[model samples]
Target chain A: MQYQSQAVAKLYFTAAIGLFAGQILFGLILGLQYVVGDFLFPEIPFNVARMVHTNLLIVWILFGFMGAAYYLVPEEAERELHSPGLAVLMFWVFLVAGALTILGYLLVPYSGLAKMTGNDLLPTMGREFLEQPTITKIGIVIVALAFLYNIGMTILSGRKTVVNLVLLIGLAGLAVLFLFAFYNPDNLVEDKLYWWWVVHLWVEGVWELILGSILAFVLIKTTGVDREVIEKWLYVIIAMTLITGIIGTGHHYYWIGTPEYWQWWGSVFSALEPIPFFMMTVFAFNMVNRRRRNHLNKVAVLWALGTAVMAFLGAGVWGFLHTLSPVNYYTHGSQITAAHGHMAFYGAYAMIVLTIISYAMPMMRGRKAANSNRSQVLEMWSFWLMTVSMVFITLFLTGAGILQVYLQRYSDTPLPFMVVQEKIALFYWMREVAGVVFLAGLVLYIASFFVGSKDPEAAVEQAASPTA
Target chain B: MTRGGSLPETSRYPPGDLAVWIFILAELAVFAIFFAAYAFTRMQHVALFDQYQATLDRNAALFNTLALVTASYFVVRAVTAIREGRTASARNRLWAAVGMGGLFLLVKGMEYAHHLGEGIRLSTNAFYMFYLSLTFFHFMHVILGILVLMVLAMRTAAGHYSAQSHTDIESGASYWHMVDLVWLILFPLVYVMH
Candidate 1:
């Protein structure tokens, strides 16, 4: 169990570092575009870059979940993985598929891929890869299947612990939800209906399951919290998630020509969606406070704590502020949406993924513990840098959205899209600056992974075992 | 195995079950929102909703609901039967419950096919959209519940579950009851309210 966990840990660390780098690179591109229009236009447009950025964020997070699953399931079940060979095979297949998918995005001509994929986003003459969503969808499914099989078989054989059961249901949800990608409905409404099935359900629904499982894994490890205590938290978190999330999708439905009542339904439920995130924050901190020991892997704990705080701010508070029908009536589909997306994903899932990587790295390397005071300090800085920048970005974008909605959406003498676009130029520039700060944070995080310390005192504190 | 010899030994109904219940309850809440949406939307298109409701096979939904309710009852009976060492009775009741759940799904699939033949789809209209999403979602849960029952039945057959080791049965039953509870709401909203 220990050996396999370490192996999975190594895979996770590599993926995390790569993902953090990707995040910063794309963030910089996005940031610069806000300031310098045409910075990479015709060569690497915003649309294509955004696809890679968002999709990579999703992919790498999934990779982290797999790693966490591989590590925890065995330990929780008190057994080895059902098939380590299958696990290894699934990992490489997913990696190769992921690499090819991204490469295919870059290398394939936009027009050709768009034509082949039937994406009607643009003429695709000079566009990057936003037009080529087919390959990406296929890649997602393959990864989902490989992951489902690996984890599914393990749970099928192993003891059905709360951790494993929740993880299994969550993974199963991942698979069922991905089925939406295969079909291409012609009607835009139908198309979006299924899209929400994949998008909203996966993130707000199953992803909550994933978060619960990961949090459970961390609590059991770091605090030696009774499995019972940790497991109960997982349940309550998931319960809160579903209670709000199902209706939360209504937020997206507001402008999608769904019923008018959705405006009310989406707002009310989405306002409640933050409750779980709030609960998650309380759960993480309460467990930490109730800890029997004072040992700290500062980086891992930093990421975990950051997950709670950022999720509250991004998914909870930000989501609620705009989720109301009255407020969203103005802000829907604006850059404000982009701001929320950036912060929420980074805050909730991204940090959780990073936490797993940081937690598992030393264990994977067979280091008794990682003693990287310098890296931990750097990581701590990165968390704040990225978080603070995102808040700035969200603030500016929200301001931009309010202006856009008031002047453009509602006014009789409505400005043209380009006119409003030009008017919001300052906010855009501010976003770009904030993006740079975020990217700098990522740079620090990636560097910290490889160039950290392993001294004994820090190691002992990290692992809570002097011998380790 | 005593840690510091101070804490009591681990109890049977551990935190896992509570956690599972919490999760299950939250899931029910999401479905509640979904059901509420269906009701709210249905109210808006009351004429069309009424027309559509009249078209539905209430008999089918009612039967499905009754079957589910009965199955949930049998699950309780099975739990009691197991407790009293009535293994054969428990097994029979469990199999019957599983069969009824399957029957509900079969009837639902047929009804869905009928609706498809009548040109209803997820986005056919507001009425059909809610109908498909709500019932289909419920159907998926039924399928899941049936799978759980199958596993419990296998375990029961193998004598792997005893009164003390019956958390699996209880959890499965709780989930089945939830499925039934959702049907209780869905039946009136989808088929009977008009």
Candidate 2:
């Protein structure tokens, strides 16, 4: 709102929410396919639906990050964006390319899509999570470059704050590491090794810097805390993130055809991955407690805090549960991995993007500082609804994972994967129910934006100083 | 900014930047979990651990321990010198600490070369995996620690810090001490303890 270019973020956020709905819908379809198996059948198979679900999630979150950067960087730098036009252009390019890719996935078989898209030239398709054809991947790279040029130039030309610097570094790292996704090989081990350079390095590595900077930016605005204090802690937290996370890449190397040494290296470093999340949790609470004045955006504050705790529980705690090689040996590809993936992605990335959107959306829409109180209350309800449902989703998956591990991997006579899955269908059903609740929560979340638009903005009350 | 006044109660203020303390606590947590994993794994394979523990050059580890301890002593002296308004002496002490750190890395590097030359690798055995993993991880910390000390030394020599304003010095020193502290535990657990 402070800068004309900041309005461009509204387009990106609106697109993000739209794709988020698409992601959850596809997620529910995939969840149903888990139990009913033939519900979607040949029309839209589970694998294709899953690809849409996950790809949508990634695309939407990228939109959210781009939107957040567009909104926050100008305010932090105290300048107009270098080229809002480039941002809008790249946004359309990314969205159209993403949509086309999803359509291809639905319309054609994956192999046919690959052949049609000339994936044989690059052959980056068919891998887990990097399933986009080579052409689309190239398009992604081009879009990323333009986006970075726009943001990076703005930050360099304006007041250089730690928040902006960290965010730029994270965004740059994200773009650079993503190049590894293009480096697929016939050597499965080598492919897997570098695949992590993209995946692990993004989520656990640079993306954390993005997450921290955004959290810091929000905390500084909402709590009226000292920027210096938050910025300092930002450096410390991100330093810990890379310190543990860089070597922590070894965790994925284990059980792959990598050397036995990775077992120790991976186990030790990754077990410590939770440290930064724990610090993040503590840092969020401590800053809020030390607030000079409470801002009227209570839901934003709630999200900032919620992101911390849930990230710790979902990414930190659940991750550590199977991070050690011994534990992973039994649980590697089971529902446990799925369990961890669902919650960790939702908690860490999905929630943080939502946090920034929650904070910035109201401002972009001409509110003074916050949405109306009724809107905030409904948003809070949505928060609890979505968050609590996610917790149950994780728990139910964990339950399924534990049972699957026992019956399929550890029993006196180990059962086959399908046989064990049949026994654990009940957990999947419960998980599907939980997924429905999550969708309902998403609906409520969307409703929150429209419910109180015409009402007066929420007012801040000067409560007694809790710290004093 | 002067610490010349009665030092703030430890209850009210931690010694270094609060930010650095948070970093320190995170680092400690990682090391703690690692040590616990080591202990748990060792309990399950006492004979294998003992067999490999014998192969380690305890004398080199003992020497490295002395180097780190002496380096920590030098860091403590540097902190004291800065507090007393002796920037030159503090700089000299930090340089001396850096030298000790260099000695530690040099010795540890030689140890690594010896092992690699012997064709022993991480995949050689479970025992070697833990030994090399833990030691090499700590070794990287030493290198990082030295880099920090070198920065602190340069800053001190340039008169960037004072008795009143030396949080950077304290923060760097705190990190170096942590590196040394982890080694102290690491040396005893992985190298000496039966």
Candidate 3:
């Protein structure tokens, strides 16, 4: 809000929320398909629905990161964005491409869509998350290039703060690593090996730098903590992140046809991955405890701290559970992976996007500091509902996974996959119910924006949060 | 970091910034896990480990240990020198520590070349896998420690440290000691333990 060009983030934030809703809806559909088997039948098909769900999640999170950068870079650099016009143009380009891609997934059979999109020339369509056609992938590269150019120019043209520098490094690392997606080796092992350079390197590796910088920016504003203090810790946290995360790539190399040393290397390193997250959790709490002023935006601070704890639990604690090569031997592709995936994504990435949105959205709309008390109350309601529901979903999937692993993979007389799945259908039913509650929370979250536009920001509360 | 205790000067606790201590503890925890993995795996394969343990060149490892221990001694001298306002002496001590670190790396590098000459790799066998992985990991730490010592040496030469303001020296010294400490454990567990 300090710079006129910061207004452009409003457009990207709105799109991110819209696509986030679409993702959760598709997620609910996928969850139902898990329990009911043929509920959607061949009309929408489970595979296509899953693709839509995951692809939408990635697209929306990218939208969120772009929006965050647009808002943050201007303020951190003490200047306007280099070109807000290009920012808006790229938003529309990304949105339209995202929409057309989703439509193609729904309308055409996946293989036929692959053929129609000229998959023969560069066959990148059938991969797990890179399910986008080669043309769309090229479009993504173009959009990313334009976006990086805009942000990069703004940082170089103005004062370079540590936050902006770290973010630039992270964003640049993201673009460079995405080029790995194009390297599709015919050897499945090699293919899987490099695929992690895109996925694991993003979430665990450089993306952490982005997360630390953004969280540092928010803490500086809300807690009035010293920038030097936050910047120093940011360096330590990101250093730990890459130190553990880079070699932490060894975890994935274990079962893949890699060398035997990965067993020790992967276990030792990935087991330490939780340390950075644990430090993040401690750092967030410590900053809030040392706050100088009581900011009006209590909810944003809540979202920030909530993200820290949940990310540690979901990504750190849960990840540590099955990461040891010995333990992974029994639970490689079981529902345990599902349980970890659901919570880790929601806690780490999804909640971060929501945190920045919560902090910036009110100011972009011309509010003084925060949303009205009513809106914040409802947002906190949504926060707990969604977060708690996710916990339930993870626990249910974990329960189903343990049972499935025992009955199907571990027992003396092992049951077949389908039989074990049938025995574990009850957990799936409970998960569907939790997924419904989550949808309700998302509805409340969106409704909060509209519910109190006219009301003044909330008066200061006297009681501090327990951790604070 | 002690609560309700004497202050830093009096207590001599941990001897550096809490941030550096956090990293030091994390690094130690990782090495602890690696050692545990080595011990647990050794328990399962005692004969293989014992048979391969003899193949290691103990003379080179013993010399590397001496090099690291001497480097740590020099770091302690550098910190003490800075505390006494002896800038030139501190810079000389730091450079001496860096030299010792170089000696360790040179010896370790020769050891690696010997292993590679024997066609041994991380995948050759479990014994070789843990041995190479653990030693090479500690070897990287030695290189990093030498870089730190060189930087500290340059800064000391430029008069950046004083008797009252030498926490950076303590922090660097703390880290180098950690690198040395890990090798002390690794040398015995991987190279000498039966």
Candidate 4:
């Protein structure tokens, strides 16, 4: 609201929410297919729907990150954006390309879509999470470049605060790492090796920089804490992140035709990855507790605190559950990976986006600072509902995973994969039920924005005496 | 800065920035796990471990341990010098500490060269894998410790810390001690505890 260009973030955030809802719908469908098997056959097969589910998630999160950068960089720099016009243009370009890619996945078979997109020239399709056609990948690069140019120019021209610098570094890193997606080697082992450079490096590596900066910005604004204190914590947290995370990449190298040294190196470093997240949780709480002013945005405060805790639980504790090579030898591709993925993505990445959105959306929408009490109450309700259901979803999948691993991998006479799947159908049904509640929570989250638009902003301390 | 400095010194709390302390704790936690893993793995391969453990140069390790311990003692002197407002004395102490770290590295480097000359590596066996991993990890900390000591020396020359305000010196010195302390454990655990 302070800068005209910041309004462009409203468009990005809105689009992010829309795509988020689509992701949940597809997620529910995928969950049902896990139990019912062929619920949406022929027209929407499992592979296609799974790709749509994951791709939508990645795109929407990218949008959310871009939106968060657009919103915070200007305020941190004390200047208007360099090119709001370019930002708006790239927004549409990225959205349309993303939508078309999803449509291609749905309408065309995998092989036909690959051919349609000229996959013969550069074969990057069929990889999990990097399933985009080569053309769309190129389009993503273009959009990322333009977006970075605009943001980078603005930060360079304006006041160079730590928040701006860290965010730019993170965004730049995201773009640079995505280039690895194009390195599709013919050797399967080599392909898998570099593939993690994109996936693992992003989520575990640079994306953490993005997450840390955004959480810092929100906490600074809502708590009225000194920028110096928060920035110090930010530097230490990120330093720890890189120190542990870079070498932590070895965890994925195990079983990928890598050397035996990776087992020792990977286990040693990755076992320490949870420390930064623990520090992050401590940092968020300490800032809020020492807050100078209690901002009227209660829900934003909740989100800021919730982000730190959930990230620690989902990404930190759950990741440690099977990070060791010995443990991972059994649970490598099992549902435990799925369990960890769901919570880690939702808890770390997804909630941080929602945290920024929750904190910034109010001011963008022309409120004094926060939403009316009714809306806040509803938003808090939605936060808990979504968060608790995600916990259940993760737990149910973990149950199914442990049972599956026991029956299929660790048994004296191991059962076949499909037979184990049928045996664990009950857990899948429970997971699908949790998925439904999550979708419902998403519905309420969207509705919270509209429910109390006309009411006066809720005061921090309610009026004491009524005057006639 | 948040809580410790405000509390009375009688509280027996740490004497540096809280942020660095958190970092130190995390780093220590990592070393602890690595040590535990080493012990657990060594239990299974006691014969291989004992066999390869004999190949290590105990005299060189003893010399490195002494060098690191001497460096840590110099840092302690540097901190005390700064606490008493002797900037010149602090600078000299930090230099001595860095010199000790360099000596440790020099002796350790020769050991590494000897091993490489024998064509030993992390892939040689389970014992060598852990021996090289744990020692190299501690070795990197020595390099970092030297760098920290040099920076502290430079800052002391610039009069950045004194009796009134020397948290930077305390933090840097404390980190150097952590490096040295890890070596104390790492030296015996890896080189002598067979």
Candidate 5:
């Protein structure tokens, strides 16, 4: 009944390291491109590198989710997985498909790729990274299906528990949302319209379910909080998510020419989206405060607690800053949106994934206690780096977004397109530097997973300590 | 961790049903918000919404409403039958509930199809948006309810529920009742009152 799996954990750990390496390399390339324009424009073009960087963030977090599902499902059900082979198969297929998709991005020039795939050529919008093609889009569907099958089979055959059921519903929602990829809206405005289905719904919708289930799992393990307490929290979180998030899709539709009511609809609902995250913060800390028995994964618990607070700030407070139609009118595509995106991803998804990994890796290795001083130090370092760098990134982007919006959107200044572009270029460089610092934290994280603590006595002492 | 204070089973109910009740309560909160939105949006454009409301056949909605109410009645009877040790009769009542629930959806779908043929679509206006969103969301829950009933029916056929282990029946009935309650609200808000 242990909530850990060695095989699945290893797959995710490996994916995380590879993805982080990609992140760091692309992070550097992206940063340099802004400072010295036309520098290395041919090899690892800005568009390709940026796509790889953003997508890698998404891929690694998914890797984390897969690992968590495998670890938690069997334990919650009190049975072994229906098929470990299927789980392993899903890992390899997704990894290989992910690699090929990235390789495809690198091999074809943006225009050439569009031409080869039969898209009409136009001036690049400079968001080279967001050009998701049909094949890669299909690849995501396949990955989601494989995960659904594995998790579905595991749940159907095992005991039905509230925690496991809630978690599976969340995962199922992820699969359903991924289906949005198949819909290729012909018009640009309509494309961005349905774009919210995948982006907004997944993160704001199903992702809420994921966060709730993960938090419930951690609390049950670490605090021995009553099953009733944890299950109720799970239900409330998902309910809030659905209530706020479904209509909250309106926020994205404000500029997409859908309807004007979304301005008010989205404003009200999204303003309330932070309530669950704030509740999550209280849930984690409150459970810890009332722990019946101490557990070994304190750092993991710390990350879980941290994810809630940061997610509320990043996705909630910061998102609200530009969510309303009035504010969003100015800040729509500015660096301010970029700022919200970075903190929200790291705060909500990144930390939750890390929490699952931290909690499970030792259990997977059959370690009886938390890791020693070195691993803890590395983890603490990881936390600080991601936290500090993200804050700075948000700061620079907010300033940049405000400036860009004022000059480009509002002002009738005489700055030419090229000149204005040059004026607002420094913020991109700042973002690149922040991304690098975040990458360093990621590298330390992957290294710690492999060469973890070897000091058993120290680990035991920490585990025995009440705070753990 | 085995406590001496655990509740004794009151006839056919088990403690796990408590968890199911708790889950139902949370679902009600979510549905409440959607209902509130439906009401608020209706208020925003009362004339358009009322015009759209008239487009819906009141007789059909009244029938659907009656069907759901009857399903709830049958489900409650099923629970009672199971508690009284009439397993076969209980299964019949549960099946009757399922059939009624299925019938309600079929009638609702036909109504939607009729309306759609008249050129009423999701993006037609705010009224249609709420009409489609609220109805479709409710339809999804109806599907879920049917699935729950199917599970309970299968279990009952396998002799899983009895006078002493019919918590499943209670939970299933509780959910069906909720579905009924939601429709009651929907009947007035979206159909008659508007």
Candidate 6:
């Protein structure tokens, strides 16, 4: 690594991958519970498994973003980190708090865990995705502040580049919006209203800034393109992102007992939400096509390109499928939301993290640019295995969603939720099988790291002509 | 400064940065989908749409249209002036374009105030929802377009651009025209069309 502080990213990335494996494992458990309802029984129920699954995904992705920022910020700013010591300290703090939270979820009843963690004093528990205890949540805020202080100070003191600036903005927004997680009023409607300020605003809003800046950094490094060209596009893309995404928050307001006008406003604006993803897809391919040299990190390039296409398909196309208020009337809170959530999260956040790790890991490990060919080949295999399995998982869920909607919502004589779920058990079975394949892919992905560590770095074909 | 000879062959492509063009295409796609949605919804509630369509201030809308079209014309003249090595004229034309944008926003703001005073909001009715949503959305674009024009004008007046290297001017103009173009479609689709 060019900077000593950049090496700290290795610890965070390794933790991220480990937690990702945990996420997939819990995901498989949740999938099984969907079919064999009593498989885990009282020992580990569906809700606990789900909390573990989702919480792990969130934690791991946070780790990935933090790791990515730690790695790229120094390079972009043309200086060493301001405080590597602070970064390492925060890493341990976040990991321990996250682990304790997960263990509490698994080892104790959620209510018991809540009581133990002083939920009565400040109850932020029992909420979707904000299920962490009050203390853990406070710890998270503290850790985030320290982390930001270190990274923000480094960026401000060093050469200011668009990549670093945009990343800082995104990270700052993430921390700020997360404060809403603490403001849970007893009014259910108002609670749901601001809940989206944290969830929706994070993914659809500022997190996109983080995603775009990282993608730009990787493309600039690998494509040998002019930084000015990439940076210009970065500005325009993020401008469109906020312009559309801020108002796109209306989509979640519908049917939440807020106001009826949100139907039209949400439908109109959220439908436009896919535009930025489409632009992101075109941007990734356009830059790669216009590459000045073929970098040796072929797998990183694959990941960067795959991130673009999959994010478009998963987040853009699937998102647009039910973003309209009329369509959402039938599909809201159904398996379709689950289907979209799985793929969109995987494609946009998960894949982007993996993309950055794939790009940075080799350099951190003392390789010139890339992994050995055998390792890369295995990694590519894992990519297709995980990606294709995810597509099938989404498709199976979509099938289940459509059938559920037909039976439960749209029929002249609608069936109850349980009755329809039992009827749609076959699709759930298919989803479980796909989930297994996804786990296998994760196993192979982990194996890729150890498989060819002894071999020499992958050689580049210098004579191969670059083609768009 | 030298002119024309240093410029790349841009005949086969759109003016300004390729990045801005991509952004323009994305914006157009969004507007296209929104318009299609509006048309489909209008078909479903033709009576309601027609009723609300009558309440709109067509005079103000017409005035705003003239302002945007004139602003676009001025933007074109500014680009032309810059191409002929006339920074002074380009700056003037750019400021004139900004002034036209200001006029559009002012007229549009008055229309919004009228609606608000009449107790109309996005929650009022389906027709009002679409009307306010479309017009207000276009209004924000006008403000953003004006910002771009002002930046370009200031930079031009400060002699930061020349005939040989004025991609920023071209890019800013391209975005302004897109804002104007969307309004042209929006004006008839929402205001004039029954």
**In terms of DockQ, which candidate is strongest?**
3
Q: Would you list the clashing residue pairs of candidate 2?
A: none
Task: Tell me the tens digit of each residue's lDDT in model 1 across B30-132.
Answer: 6787777777777778899898778899899888988999999999898888877677777788899999999999999999899999877666678877777
Q: Model 5, clash count?
A: 0
User: DockQ score of candidate 1?
Assistant: 0.19
Which residue runs does candidate 2 get wrong by more than 4 Å?
A461-468, B1-13, B36-63, B191-194
Work out the TM-score per prediction: 0.71, 0.94, 0.95, 0.94, 0.73, 0.95
The digit string of per-residue lDDT tens for model 2 on B72-179 reads 999999999999989999999999999999999999999999999999888787778788888887898899999999999999999999999998888899999999
Model 4 lDDT per residue over A227-328, tens place? 988998998899889878988999998999987999988988988888899999999999998988777888898888998999998999999899999999
DockQ, prediction 3: 0.75
How well is each residue in A1-468 modelled by candidate 5, as lDDT tens digits? 264343575677668657857866776787677667767778777767778888888788788887888888888777777778777887888788788767767887766666665544332222323355555556667777877787778788888878788778888888787665555566877877766787788899987788789878877887888887777667766766787788888888887767666775686667667767766776778888888876666677778788888898898888889887788887887778888987898889888887777777676666664665567667878887878888888888788778878777778764555565678778878877887898788777767765555655135465666543
Tens-digit per-residue lDDT, B32-69, candidate 4: 98899899999999988888888899999898889888
After aligning candidate 6 to the native by TM-score, how far in Å is the CA of A128 from where it should be?
Answer: 0.5
Q: What is the C-alpha local distance difference test score of candidate 1?
A: 0.75
- In candidate 4, residue A401 scores what lDDT? 96
Model 3 misplaced stretches (Cα beyond 4 Å):
A460-468, B1-9, B158-160
DockQ of the two-chain complex in candidate 6: 0.61
**How would you order the candidates by DockQ, starting with the best?**
3, 4, 2, 6, 1, 5
Instruction: Please give the C-alpha DockQ score of model 5.
Output: 0.09
Candidate 4, position A182, lDDT: 98
Give a tens-digit lDDT track for model 3, residues A362-465: 99999878999889989999999999999999999999999999999999999999999899999999999999999999999999999988888776663244
**Candidate 1: tens digits of C-alpha lDDT, residues A2-85:** 645437546755875686578568767866776677987787787667767766776788778888888877777766777777
- Residue-level lDDT tens digits of model 2 in A1-468: 789999999999999999999999999999999889998789999999999999998999999999999999999999999999999999999999999999999999999999999987777888888999999999999999998999999999999999999999999999999999999878999999999999999999999999999999999998898998999889988999998899999999888899877887788789889989988999999999999887788899999999999999988999999999989999998889888898889999999999999999998999978999899999999999999999999999999999999999998999998998899999999999999999999999999999999988886452224324
On a 0 to 100 scale, what is the lDDT of residue A215 in model 4? 97
* Local accuracy by lDDT, each model: 0.75, 0.92, 0.91, 0.91, 0.76, 0.92
DockQ of 4: 0.71
TM-score of 2: 0.94
Pairs that collide in candidate 4 are none
Q: What is the TM-score of chain B in candidate 3?
A: 0.94
Q: Give candidate 6's error at residue B172 in angstroms.
A: 1.2
CAPRI band for model 1: incorrect
